[model samples]
Target: MTGFCNMVIISLFNWIYILSFFVVYTADAGVQNHHVDKQNNSKRLLMDENYYTIMSRLDNLTKEVEALKKENALLRHSPIAFLAELTKTVSGQNHQIHFDQVKVNIGNAYYPSHGNFIASVNGLYQFSITACSTANHYVVLELTVNTSVVGKVLAGDTGYDECSSKTFLIQLSSGDDVFVQHKSQGDYLLSASAYGFPSFSGVLLRAL
Candidate 1:
């Protein structure tokens, strides 16, 4: 820009010199020279505008990069993960239903022995379950978060084979427990398969 301004100053001095020397020149020639100068001035103005536009765009790109970096940092510390199952059967009454098979246990939140998931961070979570039972046997499954029943599903209601599945989302605090439990008494079994057909799953949807 400094160079451009210097050139403009030189051009202005030269134009003054031309005007003084061309005073005795034909009127038509003088008019043509002035028109040419106007065109060059317009072109320079356009170039200056383009330079500012480019600088503005560059600054916007820098800001976007910074925002992406912050988002990535948040994800690194985000308490978000999922746990699912494929095979294992649960049965009985008023007990935590265990999924013998685990497909995804993000952060190792789910424990097979205790049949529950302990949240590692405070966040919103999504839970789902599909419990299957044999003929004439209906199993009531309750989705619980720290002894509070948030959702429920029932299987074995369908004649030959029964499958009950549901998905819901909830907010949880760190160290909170999440699990599916058998609601009713009697001989009822939940079917889990190696193919992961009937299962329970939960995921940390977002960090609080």
Candidate 2:
């Protein structure tokens, strides 16, 4: 009976040891599985963050490109330049007149000459003129465009009353010419001025 009892106790001990070993192995496997799952989740989160960053960068680049395109278009369509031409005529000793600072040179002394002042763009032109005489002088001023007379002014009073200025709103073409003429037969001291060419700065962009 004693021998039988000892044999039973040893059998029970061996069974408990085997069960404990299996439980430990199972716990270790579970732990390894949890660690692998955590690692996978971490990798996925990093990938999502990187993808968002890349998309944001691409969006910003696209906006910049669009803005550049608009700027380029505006520059291409804007007007290029504006121009101004001026001339003056002074009375000689007798009834003779001399032309100075003629912006456009058309013909020689004999034939009826034509001169031009062109604006590079089509816009409202502010035409102006100022004239004065030392003595009682009679002067006829005629404004012309493309050789066609548009308006006229006469100055022949005793004092500064005859000194006058005129401004006109003129629509100009790319290569149009504006000119002034002395209509009266007698020679008179005269001076003329103009502004608005080569981009509204009173400078000529081209010679015509």
Candidate 3:
């Protein structure tokens, strides 16, 4: 009877120990699985943040590209040159010579009514003037920029019909005015014809 009781007690103790080991193992496995899950979640969050940052940068780049395209389109369509000629004989001192006939007025910068070129943009510009004098008469033509003399041309006083021309380069601001005026005194007749009319021209060389 004592041997049977001892065997029964030993078996009970063994069973209790096995149950405790199984409990410990289950708890440890659960902890390890939780740690793995936490690590995976952190990686997923970091990946999401990186994705958002990349998308924002791409959006800004697209906006900048669109702005550049619009600026290029505006530059391609702008106009900047003119050519004109006098329609009637002009003479005398300090007279603003109105070239009333427009041949190629690009941008409409040159006005035939007032005979002036008004700059629409700030830029480097080139201007030219041509004048023809009647036989035995002389005339002087001046190119003026906003009331300042910038260039001049002299036709003949040498007893024959003669033509003279001058070209000038200047920097102009927006709203500046350029025109031609008679600069000499006395009865000097300036002539115009289909073959050789007094002419004026201007072009914007480069925009600032």
Candidate 4:
């Protein structure tokens, strides 16, 4: 009886040792798995953050490129803007004249008339002229565009003897002549009063 009880106790101790060893090994394996899962989660989060950062930077770069493209398109389409820029560059570089009864004689003897202003260069030109008659006189004015006349204005008749003014616009090419000639003769002067006589002024801008 004593021997059997001792044997039973030894058998129980061996079984307890085996079970404890299995429990310790399982716990260690679980801890390692938990650590690996945590590392994987951290890596995923880092990757997500990096992706978001890159996306934001790409979006900003795209917007910047779009803005630059719009600006370039506007500059390309707006001729006035380009002309303003060009005028700024050449401002104060050339001689400008406000014509009021100013005689422009090309050489010495080619005194064509007192009314015609000739251009030397061939390009698009914008012309503006204003003329007035005073006192007992009639005004007959013609605005010539290239070789064809574009506008004509007449003032003063038998009964209506007062001050009259006319304005006109013309486009010219190179070697084009723009001028005014008096059709009637009387004791009337071109350009009277403090408002000044008939005048012409404008710049040659490129055509559309």
Q: What is the lDDT of candidate 4?
A: 0.50
* Candidate No. with top TM-score: 3
* Minimal lDDT window, size 10, model 1: 189-198
Which regions in candidate 4 have their CA more than 4 angstroms from the true location?
81-208
Q: Report the error of model 3 at residue 131, Å.
A: 0.7
The lDDT, on a scale of 0 to 1, for candidate 1 is 0.76
Per-residue lDDT tens digits for candidate 2, residues 1-208, read 9999999999999999999999999999999999999999999999999999999999999999999987676445433322223244456333212223334332221111233355554545555444444356766556666767776555556664345556555666666666666655435644443322111112322221
Task: Name the lDDT of candidate 3.
Answer: 0.85
The TM-score that candidate 2 achieves is: 0.42
Please provide TM-scores, in order, for all candidate models, with all chains considered together.
0.58, 0.42, 0.63, 0.41
Which pairs clash (backbone N, Cα, C closer than 3 Å) in model 1? Answer: none
lDDT (C-alpha) at residue 207 in model 3? 70
When summed lDDT is taken over every stretch of 10 residues in candidate 2, the lowest stretch is 195-204
Q: TM-score of the candidate numbered 3?
A: 0.63
Instruction: State, as a TM-score between 0 and 1, how close model 1 is to the true structure.
Output: 0.58
Ranked candidates, highest lDDT first: 3, 1, 2, 4
Better of 2 and 4 by lDDT: 2
